[model samples]
Target: MIGLCLGLAGLVWAQVPTPAFTLAWDHTIEKIRWEEDYRVTPQGLLLGEARVRGSGAGMEIPEGAELKDGSWRYHRTLPPLQPLRVGRTPEAGDYQLCFDEQCHVLSEWLGPPTAEQPALELWSCAQVE
Candidate 1:
């Protein structure tokens, strides 16, 4: 029984993939900051925290949301993906980060980070204070 339990746990852990890279954005001019930690698994992509910044509005998205067609709701249901790309996600030219309550539009394309860039894991939550 213990061995079977261990096997099941291992199987579940193996399926929960970790992200290859971190993501972040700061539109300080508009006082907007977005940070997300994500990973793609066989089931779909998983997002954590999804902390918000800049919008005095206190918008919060519950964790454990899956990335489906660029959108995730309070429930874990996912949207649809296009070909090899996950829908509604940032790419190079077309991307949309829509949370349960708020959405932050992103470019589909991304460029290399600059020296002035802050650490991905620890970007400031709020530009003001």
Candidate 2:
């Protein structure tokens, strides 16, 4: 099994079990729901699928995406991302990180964002060395 690393202000803050996980958030501009699924790989983090409920500004439905059951679903062939950054700001609200059949608020894991900490970094623990 591999572990997922969470970093704050360039330092490792916490780690979580991450064979696969889903991140859900509401679009800041459209106020619509969006979700993405990712899996940990030796190369990095691989995005498997993305889904969004409705579309609006900055939320263009990707080409080849299918509208099914009121949501647009699609997949991308992007390379494994070494580290994914999640920003924290009043305007952007919070993110829901889920795995192991449970969901947690970003703040619950990283605590409230402060002036000094503007974002959280996510990467596979294999890179810790």
Candidate 3:
């Protein structure tokens, strides 16, 4: 009975969800567009992107954007004056943008902006998965 209990406990512990990785970037890259590619991997979800932007606030990379070899690629018509590296672990909280073998961006609070700041903020979210 004790062995069975221990096995059950082990199963339960293994079932516990892993924490998401949190990544933060400057608020400036919010202007440029971004994309994410999702894939299934042994490590849960893998995210990658083709482009990222850099600005004064810091750096802005697409959320849920795919990552490869711990690095991502960003492209622009005009070579980025400055590029910011993306792909850091995320924190939990039902993020507005999340990547888990798939890209999903919350649409509830997402819509057209009322003001310039709101417009920019909304644009920033659009870049996320």
Candidate 4:
């Protein structure tokens, strides 16, 4: 009986989910900017710039702009190549930044949503800051 109980306990412990950490954005929407420097095999390097915006407001990230009301979401298809470098902020919540092998910032918001019914949404590229 003791061995059976210990075995069951071990099984339950294995079923537990991994703990997740929250990530905070340093700059606000106004200050936030997405700059991608691409490097080609033959060529050297290319710089590209894009603006980040909210889904509802559609307001562009200005200088020193902060995220008003948003949560970090993740996507399975587009996984980030490296772990996210999180900062200090209260808006942060339970989430994990997904990355790929290359260690590129593939997706910041790539995890399950808070609510189950509404369904989780995943945004990519400039959309994620």
TM agreement with the true structure for every prediction: 0.30, 0.89, 0.25, 0.18
Each candidate: what lDDT? 0.31, 0.83, 0.28, 0.24
- Each model's RMSD to truth, in Å? 15.7, 2.4, 15.7, 17.0
Q: Candidate 4's residue-wise lDDT over 45-103, tens digit each?
A: 12222223333334434554444334222222323322112232233232222222222
Model 1 weakest lDDT span, ten residues long: 1-10
Candidate 2 is scored at a TM of 0.89
| Tens digits of lDDT, candidate 2, 67-110 | 99888999999888778888877668888889999889878878
Q: Candidate 3 lDDT, tens digit per residue, 35-126?
A: 43332233333343344433234454546544554544543333211111222222212122333443333222233222322211110111
Off by over 4 Å in 1: 1-20, 56-129
Q: Which lDDT tens digits does candidate 1 get at residues 1-129?
A: 000000111221111112222344543335455555544333334444454443434444457654444434334334311111222222222223343344433322223323332211111111121
lDDT of 2: 0.83
CA error at residue 100 for candidate 4, angstroms = 25
Residue 52, candidate 2: Cα error in Å is 0.5
TM-score top scorer: 2
